[model samples]
Target chain A: MQGLFVVFRKELCDHFSSYRFVILFGLIAMVSFITSYMAGVHMKENLEALSKTRFSFLMLFSTPGALFSMVQFVSFFGPLIGLVLGFDSINRERAQGTLIKLVSQPIYRDAVINGKFLAGVATISILLVSIVLVISGFGLALVGVVPGIEEIWRLFIYLIISIFYISLWLGVSILFSILFKSIATSSLASVALWIFLSFFVTLGAEVAANAIAPMDRKKETKPEILIKNTRIKERVSLSSPMVLYSKATEIIINPMRKTTGSIVMMMPMEQILSSRFQNPLPLGQSVIIVFPHMTALIAITLICFAISYLVFIKQEIRT
Target chain B: MDADTIIQTVNLTKRYGKQVAVDDLNLSVKEGEIFGFLGPNGAGKTTTLLMLLGLSQPSEGSASLYGLDPLRKATEVKRLVGYLPENVGFYEDLDAIQSLEYVANLNGINKEEALGKIDKLLELVGLKNDARKKINAFSRGMRQRLGIAEVIIKDPKILFLDEPTLGLDPEGAIWFMDFIASLNRDRKITVLLSSHNLSQVQKISHRVGIMINGKMVADGSMESLAREKFGVGDKEYSLEEIYMEYFQEV
Candidate 1:
């Protein structure tokens, strides 16, 4: 326990002091700041329309800003923060010959891996919380509206999910760092995995959906075929961490979002009956809607971290 | 095993797939002795050292330090043994004091106590003036000197040095050997120095062990080994000739 704390403190200090960390933090903060600012300005212009809404304050986060919402932007770029922090965590020490010296100390082998993992998670939490608070403060100033207690609770839950989502990537990068001996190879492999999961998975989902449910060009597309296509796409894209995280955050941040699957699933008759109610979902209902997604995200994060921990403990330190 | 033995290996073996890295080797070193470990590049000297220090586990057999199994009581064994790898490295972004402080911290030394000890160790290694310099700016000799300070930061009972003088100049190498010898004498610390440089090892080692192809080929003092190979009354054989003779035989 003592050794673990020692390593954790040292790693945390190193993370904060590294130039790479500062640059990455700056990039994320600047991009997210611009995104929230745009959303705030748009909300401010349409105050009368947004005033009747249940969670108007949260629109600053869920509304489209510039090109994408703050949630969407984070889902796309947050993994980079995780990847950069962990891609070289172990391999760089091995390459520099510090690993042997470290392990030779009177400390349990697991302490090294556990300490690094905790430090990475801590850094992610710090980054996410600060970014969310800064954006919320800007939103308050621009829209002249304060978040209610329920809104605060929802935002807190959103932050937790985001942390878990990014940490999944951190665990993956740390796994690569342990498997590959060279820092360059580990980093390249991490980035490649990130790209495959983030972008290619969606494209593959489209292809898979099309192959599964072909849409004929000769006749007008049937609603049944389109519904089947949407279902297949949603199910297949769930294989990706980014998709899972985005879906979960979208529903959590926007209470108006009540479903995880296709809108076509809601029958026309049912839509007519439900259209009379413009009330947003309660906090409990929103959480229940995304429970499966949150579960999958947390499970995958734990599994990835468990694998990295095992591999690091079992690996031979020959260099 | 003798009562004074600080390190002992019983049929110690390590295998990577079908090839053996360290064979069923039986070796022991007593407390407070500078034991020279001489071997070629692929002779498994480093592998055995790693196993002894609990850094690597053997596929078969076992090793013990202070009668504690390295494989099981790893933390305890490591507390008593310090290992300096062939090419020792430090965190390049950190200065000398910071680097040593990290090592000190890992060994569970408090900041107040570590600072004072670090200052003395830095002065001993002649790195006092460069205490605030980043490791990236340090030369090879300075790194090796710092490596020594790091190894002894915990006041370990034994030292395992693998190719510690590989990159040093002749003068530097001599100085390093002398420093190690003095450390052994004054502190009563057992030293296991592995190197390919026979002259330096022959100068201070109370006894020497030669390993070849994952096996200990010869183990004895200079006088004993010379007498066993060359009959009594022959001119003193340089470790080079003895080492060559063993090399040719093997």
Candidate 2:
């Protein structure tokens, strides 16, 4: 425990002293402020142009909607922060020739990796949470209403989900740090992986599904294409956690809004409950679906951490 | 197996792919002795040091420090050992005092104790006046001195220094030699230092182990090895010449 604390303190202090924390927080703050301002402008325009109806206090419930969009934006940039913070966690020590000095101290190699992960996570968490609070405060003030218990609950869930998503990226960064020996290589590898997951993975999954289960040529004139497309869409949807979370949130937030439109325009749980059936899946079932995504996020994070630990332990550190 | 033996490596070997860095070597360093590990570049001095310090594992045999296996009981061994690598660097933005404090914290020293000792260590290493200056502003010699201060913070029973005086000026080199001598003589610290500077090693180390082509070619007291292995003659054989002679035979 003491050894772990030592590594944690060293990493944390280094983060602050090296301008890592400053740069990360500055970027997150700038991005969040911009996103909030944009959301505010859109909301103001809708109110002025559409009707004289006061901006609904219920729009504050849309904090999750804003948060969801921002979370996606944050994810795109989060990995860069993770890569920068973690890419040199070990390699720089080896390059600077401090690995021997550090390992020679009374500490386990696992402790070093754990401490680094902790520091990186802590730094990101603090910056992101601060942004969330700032956006939430400004949003509440703009909407001009006190959020109800249910709305607050949804926002809390959104915050927790975002944290898990960030953790997933952090884990990938640490894994890259362990696999590559130079800071440049590690950073590049992490960014590449981030790009693959954030963009290419979704596109690739779609292309793959289409290729494997192509539209039936014989039934091109039939309505089966629609049904096949729906199935393919659902399968492709599973490839993206962001999509799943958004779907689940929409379902729980406003089940009353329903659509017989394509599955793509399907309403969230709240709309489904109010429209399709007198009673939707009990609150518990709705939570169950949303719950697995959080679990998946956590599980992936742990797996990344486990892989990093193995690589670090087995690493020669000669570089 | 004696309690006095600070380090014992039995057939310890490290291989990078097909090339053996430290091939099947046995070595022992007793407590309170300045044991110099001498070799040319690529002769596996750093590899051997890393294995002994538990930073890298050996492919074949085993190593123990103070009766504990470095592989299995690494944390325990590390607690009692301080290592200075060939190129020592600190967080460039941190001043001397802050760097030392960071190291002290890693070594589990209490904050109050670490602060007090940081002052004393900075004074000891002649960096007290420049403690507030960032490490990037420090000269190579100053960095080396600070490195030494970091390693010795816990006053470990054993010290592993790899090329401690490699880039130092003559005066700085001499100061480092004196510091090592004092640690061994006055404080009874066991030192296992690897160096390519043969003459400096001879001056400070009681016994020197000469490695060639990943093998220990000679191991004995400085005088005995010099006289017996190199031969006593009117024309003196430098340590480099002796090293070449041994490798030539292989």
Q: What TM-score does the predicted chain A of each candidate obtain versus native chain A?
A: 0.97, 0.79
Docking class of 1: high
DockQ of every candidate structure: 0.84, 0.66
Write model 2 residue lDDT over B8-46, tens digit each, in one string.
Answer: 999999898999999889999898889988877899988
The weakest ten consecutive residues by lDDT in model 2 chain A span A252-261
What local lDDT score does residue B235 receive in model 1, on the 0 to 100 scale?
Answer: 98
Global Cα RMSD, each model: 1.4, 3.9
Name the candidate that leads on DockQ.
1
TM-score of chain B of each: 0.98, 0.94
lDDT of 1 by residue, A202-234 (tens): 999999999999888899889889899888998
CAPRI tier for the interface of model 2: medium
